[model samples]
Target: MENKRKELLFSREDIQNRVKELGKQIAKDYEGKKILAVSLLKGSFIFAADLVREIDAPVRIEFMTTSSYGHGEETSGHVKVVHDLNMDLKDYDVLVIDDIADTGLTMEFVLEHLKAKNPASIKCCVLLDKPSRRKTELEADYVGFTIPDKFIVGYGLNYGDYYRNVPYVFAFVD
Candidate 1:
């Protein structure tokens, strides 16, 4: 499994530091506002957990599982909501947190769906952004890192659910 990785892209320490910075920024931006941190699951859970702890302001957390990729490297261009949030998004400042914005299809689907729920505002925060692979014009409101088009795994991202526990993010060698 170790041999599959080409090289490390972001170390655990590096990611933690960046997450802290993002948390601080989010706290400031949403000061005195009701924040609901909606985590797109199976990938961004780890990031969301860390981020919310860093935020000084009170924040509610929710999880939803939406996928364009079903245990594969590339998306099929079809999004599915495997799990939905339990709470109504009305009046909450919704911050959608995701692992990566690759083709933008998943994010677009999520944002549009949440918009119908009549949230006060909606914004996206992504751990990684690969604009080169974007099929839509959408962009993340807050991006932890803008990476080149690479098949990345680890740090809650995975290859067939195998490498999510890895502490660092890396690309596959072969």
Candidate 2:
């Protein structure tokens, strides 16, 4: 096994600060509104956990696990919801959180699906946005970073379902 390299894309402090900023913005935007934070699981877990604690509002949390990368390090354009949320998203402002936005195909599909449920509003928030790889014309309401088009893993992101325990982002050289 190749020893994973250490690269500091976003430090712990950096994540904390940005999440606080996002929380502040979210709090302000959805003050007194029923907010439903729908986190794309296994990846956005850490980010969603931290972000929700910072928000000073009445918010609900749910998780959905969708996978498009089966045994590879890239997307397959097919997202499967391994787990689904149990919340009834009727009149809430749904905020979809993910670790990164790559092809946007999955995000687009999820957003459209949720929108059809007659939610008051729906938005997306991603920890990283690799716009260079986007195949769909979707944007995140809150993005932590606009990274170069490279395979990265850490801070809840992963490679081969590994390296997500790393606290910082590192380029995975395949």
RMSD of each: 1.2, 1.5
lDDT of candidate 1 over 52-154, digit per residue (tens): 8988998999999997899889999999999998778887999999999999999999999999999999999999999999999898999999999989988
Q: Write the residue-wise lDDT of candidate 2 on 1-174 in tens digits.
A: 256555567788888899999999999989888999998988899888888998899888988888887758788998877887665688899999999999998889889877877788999999999999999999999998889988888889877768778777778453
Off by over 4 Å in 1: none
The local distance difference test score of model 2 is 0.86
The list of candidate 2 runs beyond 4 A from truth reads none
True-vs-predicted CA distance for residue 114, candidate 1, Å? 0.1
If scored against the real structure, what TM-score would every candidate get?
0.96, 0.93
Model 1: pairs clashing at backbone N, Cα or C within 3 Å: none
